[model samples]
Target chain A: MKTQPLVIAGRTFASRLFTGTGKFSSSALMEEALLASGSELVTVALKRVNVADADDDILRHLGHPQFSLLPNTSGVRTAKEAVFAAQLAREALETNWLKLEIHPDPKYLLPDPVETLRAAEELVKLGFVVLPYVHADPVLCKRLEEAGVAAVMPLGAPIGSNKGLLTREFLEIIIGQSRVPVVVDAGLGAPRTPPPPSKWAPTRCW
Target chain B: MSFRPIFESHPWDDVKASIYAKTGADVERALAAPRRTLDDFRALISPAAAPYLEQMAQLSQQRTRQRFGHTVQLYVPLYLSNECQNICTYCGFSLDNKIARRTLSSVEMLAEAAVLKGWGYEHVLLVTGEANQTVGVDYLEKALRTLRPHFAHLSMEVQPLDQEDYERLIPEGLNTVLVYQETYHQDDYKKHHPKGKKSNFHYRLDTPDRLGRAGIHKMGLGVLIGLEDWRTDCFYAALHLDYLERTYWQTKYSLSFPRLRPAEGMLQPKVEMSDRELVQLICAYRLLSDEVELSLSTRENPTFRDHVVQLGITSLSAGSKTNPGGYAVAPESLEQFEISDERSPAAIAAMLRRQGLEPVWKDWDATLTALAR
Candidate 1:
């Protein structure tokens, strides 16, 4: 049986997999792995690509017709910086879809829920499809939904930790409560245990 | 808000003892750690880490190359004045030195700038002895106005000024300020700077805070290497750097290691920092922070400066004149300190190219700051 397509911000994704472009040894290898994953949505960090350069290595590899770019404000630490970087990325990458990430603490890469909520509200008002990466806190998820974010991406663990579903209980709560599509964005180590097919399936996993 | 509290808390003796107490195990731990801390910096600069010089040098070279690439920013110092009210014990420009004091007139300053421009220097450091009367904010403002159109970047190594003065000069195209705490040891500091405004250790210590608050683009920091225990003094410098970096996140910081050089009738260096030890200190700084610009001045010998470009140095001064009008206007004047490397700027640029590094003359522009405004 065919599964239902995940719809977010008036766009439908045929594949449930969302891929991230980081930590690959080579851009070619990253492109190969992403193609193999068959992800229709890919997240690219604004810090990683020289957005002004059309021939940037990462941008050069991500020209596939099926993929839609989600530019992320990854290195920004405050609502002000997030807004500035989002505007720059929107202009450079030519995309209104943004991954609003504001992590003041660099060591843990934990999202600042307050700054995230503030930036998300502003960005949504500015007509952006804002997808905010946040902790698997159900309350924060509901707050982001109220802020009019396009989607809520809750982490399974600290970013790049390779520890799957460390916040499983909170993820379940966020999935149950969130009105927008809930995407599991970080720290899924392996594909062994996908959340069992159910009414509260994650919109996409990266 | 100021670095004074943090500076006072890290007392010299306590910091010295902690650094000297670092064992070989601590050095190894620091070397192996992926992300180093200030404690790791203490370990790296400790005498116990001398045997690991090669390892530290390799890491420093790699880190420097990764961050700054194969280029060395070239700058020349334009000595605007030798006038001073401070009686620094080790300086020829001291008030009690009884030498003819000279402050370059606007015409003389323009003449000096013409010579530096001829040498293809785009970054010029304006140096002056502490004389608020002769080389005060007004003099500096006019000098910057005269020279700003001739160069892309302007730095000053003059007397410490108030925050408002710095704020005023910054808009006049002053991009950088170098304020070295001659020594961090408070009592020893008093011994060096006996009288005059320099004797106020607290004010001198808090100058970086003032500069940061004034929104200066960059600030260079160091302690004159031969004053006290070099390791402890550097630790305090590093501490100050860490504080300022966190406090004023927008300002870029650079590090200079100026060992005491012989001047006419100047006091001898109490504690000598050998070339190997200086190398160790330079590498330690690179390992500590990958982004802080490491600068080598003309005080170092030609051979040493030639070799150090590959290590961790990001900026170098070529054909420097430490006396007012020493470049062309008044070559007979007594220099603040005798320059060891007298190589011309062209010679240094060629040497950098021979080592497969490009010599960058202009890396910043006033238009960029104007555009930001």
Candidate 2:
């Protein structure tokens, strides 16, 4: 049977790959990669965009009808800051959607699950469609799902380490129990290969 | 969400002292038994377990090999920024330290990621400091975006954020967040973190609670060694881990022993844990919870790291840089702390091979992230 589109918080995503506008050699290359990956929901960090300017480089390049922008509160370290960033993103990008990531440690770039949960609870109450970045704990996935999260993004490994899922058992648990959707975030695929575990590492296993 | 009792409150010191007072017979019971409990772990970690160290080693080695197989999950940290507002005494990037501050622009993050990718890494850690205004959530999101396209999976290590923040990041293709309680000793923690948001020891102490409520996928926990009595802090960490595992049954947990290292204007660690003690802790973690991950970093010397892998460590970091763009951008910039085992990824891989263990490089998928969207 063919896979169906993933619907989250009332929005339907035709493609599963959530492309980012950050890494390509150029925006054109990023666009090419995004198209090739067949991703519909694209995530962009609110930091890179010049929200005050109507014309922003990355934002303009990401302007496509088929794609949805997921402005993430990646920089804010507190729930309060994330709430403010989310409000700003909602106003500037004209969308009540956000990706919440709060981490205090800079060395390993680890996420703070405590603050993330707090934010998810409040954001859901605030009417903003929230997606959270967390570990591969299955129960947490369920809780976020219960908290009305669009999806649960659990790491295959540490972010940008390209380490791929070190927490395999946990990821499996999260995947098995997730209700909304289980997106294997961070540390799965190779930057260059992007396909095989040895070459690219992203398994479309979902 | 009804659950079993989290844990019966025991003064962490008492538990440590009890662990310290374990006799060889206790270690024998701990080793000879089919199933072990927290008490058994105490026996195994106690000083009296010394004469039986060789015996403990054999058991730990066998248990580890059996559970983990002959493999090691390898990862590298891409330091994206070093700006901070928190005044953590033992940290390299503590706000009080007058060091150079750097935050990677979207492009710089990619440049740094390219280096990690070149090392055959599939999982990446997007690391940064706690400068809310500059390298805040938006900055992290952008970094993940910049990285998500290139990497299969993404993980981050930065400042803690609210639950909604984590929830939101989930949609953006960001995953696991690891937060270590430098010390569970609230008063000592306050002394270490004298200013900034991090100074709120209660908020930091209650972080896992928030993570549980937010429903994060997995949360890694640890207490920085040298900040407090390792045993007591670890007991609290174990207690917290037990509670977290039970309370947030769905979330996974991992532990790291981040010993205080000499950094730019960083304070000296109060108690230096010997390599022997660290091994005991790792083995104890395994004995206590067979499933929990024990990660060893490059902070330790090559010799010590080489030995501990055989003891219980499931995850290892090979070539790591602690400063932003340390991998590629500003190679000579002030590192968060000096790394001891400066081995290349290949060297670490070779080392694992020599020990009859395979080095695991990739763990997540870009297609999965894409597929989830």
Candidate 3:
């Protein structure tokens, strides 16, 4: 059976497995794991890579044709900084695709809904395909959809906690009502831990 | 009002006494604690923690890698001027020193920028002495405007300016400002800087507050290590950083520890810190906050730089010429201080690679600030 490709902002992604470039001990290991996973859409933190350097290590390994870069504004705290960083990432990485994240608290890395909504509106106006990292709030998801985000990344749990779909109830609500693609970012511990496809099929685990 | 109230609350002598009184048990407790605090930091920097250097280094390496990855950021300093109006006891740029002062013209500044660009450097730190008449706000604005287009990141380490001055310069592509409180000891601070605008310790103490209010993207904080008791000074700096991080929740912060080195007729360090002690301080900082940026400069010898790269440092400066026009125009002029590691950018990059870490030269970009206008 042939599975349908995932489409985001007119770009078709063959693989729905989205990966992030962080936490690996070395670039070689990260590259190996990412290739083995066969993920087509990868996210890189703008703060982590030297965008101006042609030979940035993380970027050097991610130059495969099958992979598309989704630069994230991870360290920014306000909408103004997010907009500025999004434009910079677009200019340097040559991708209008952005993962808008504005988390003021450092302990849990929880996304700020107000700032996320504000930045999403501004970024969409600036011609960016913003996919905001936000909590599993159905109302905020609808609001982001109204603001023209290419997708909405709602948390399964607090980022990196590895608890596995602690927000399943909220996730079901968001997935049922979301007008755009839903990517469940963070907190899936193992490959077998994701809920069955009877819940929602297209919302990939990241 | 400012950091003044917090500064006034902590008596220097008492803080020193408490740090000295920390025991081996306190060190163990601090090491084992899940969430470290200001008191835990004291125990980590105390003499009792000296025996656990290897353990601290391992923990520090783990925390650093977990947060920053296996990478180090490289930046270079561009001396825009050697002019000064301050009389400081430790510096070679004091008003009493007899030397030829030079301020780069807009043309001369760009000439030097071209050299750094050739080296493939996108981050540049613009340095100047405390001469308001020559290298004041207007001069800094012009320098930023001239070099903004050529570099991805521009940081300033000149004399402290007002809140409004920082507000004006941020839109001109100034991303960071580094103001080191030479010493936190008020008496020694007065003695070291007795004859100029820098003599106003309170104004200098409040500079970071002003920068935070101006909404700078980042700021660097530290005390010149040899000025007072290193442990006490560092604890206060950590405390100050704690205050700033909570107060200026929106701004990012970095910390640099610059040991006083020899310069043209410079004063000797009152208390010399061993290389081992410096390593302990670096590890202690990482253990305290996994997020704060730790930077090492060229003042230390090459061997020291090589050894400490794995021990929690995230930023480094290489191929640094501390004198204005030293790179292209005037190589014979006097420098602010003698740089020890004197390696080229490529050589340093090679060194980082040899140690299994990637060297990053352009982690920032100009478009990050372009929209501020």
Winning model by TM-score: 3
lDDT scores in order: 0.86, 0.75, 0.88
Residue B31 lDDT in model 2?
A: 83
Off by over 4 Å in 2: A1-206, B1-8, B369-373
Q: After superposition, how far is residue B191 of candidate 2 from its true place, in Å?
A: 1.3
TM-score of the A chain in candidate 2: the value is: 0.88
Candidate 1 vs 2: which has more lDDT: 1
Per-residue lDDT tens digits for candidate 1, residues B1-373, read: 7888888788778999999999999999999998789999999999999999999999999878756656788999999999999888899899999888899998999899999988878799999999999999999999999988887789999999999999889878898999999899999999999999999999999999999888777899999989899999999999999998888876789999999999876788889999999999999999998778999999999999988889999999999999999988999998999999999999999898788776776665454333222
Greater DockQ among 2 and 3 belongs to: 3
How should the candidates be ordered by DockQ, best one leading?
A: 3, 1, 2
TM-score per prediction, in order, is 0.69, 0.63, 0.90
Residue-by-residue lDDT tens digits, candidate 2, B330-351: 9999999899999999999989
Candidate 1 residue spans exceeding 4 A from truth:
A1-206, B371-373
Better of 1 and 3 by lDDT: 3
Q: Please give the clash total of every predicted structure, in order.
A: 0, 116, 0
- TM-score, first chain, each model: 0.94, 0.88, 0.94
Task: Give the B-chain TM-score of model 2.
Answer: 0.93
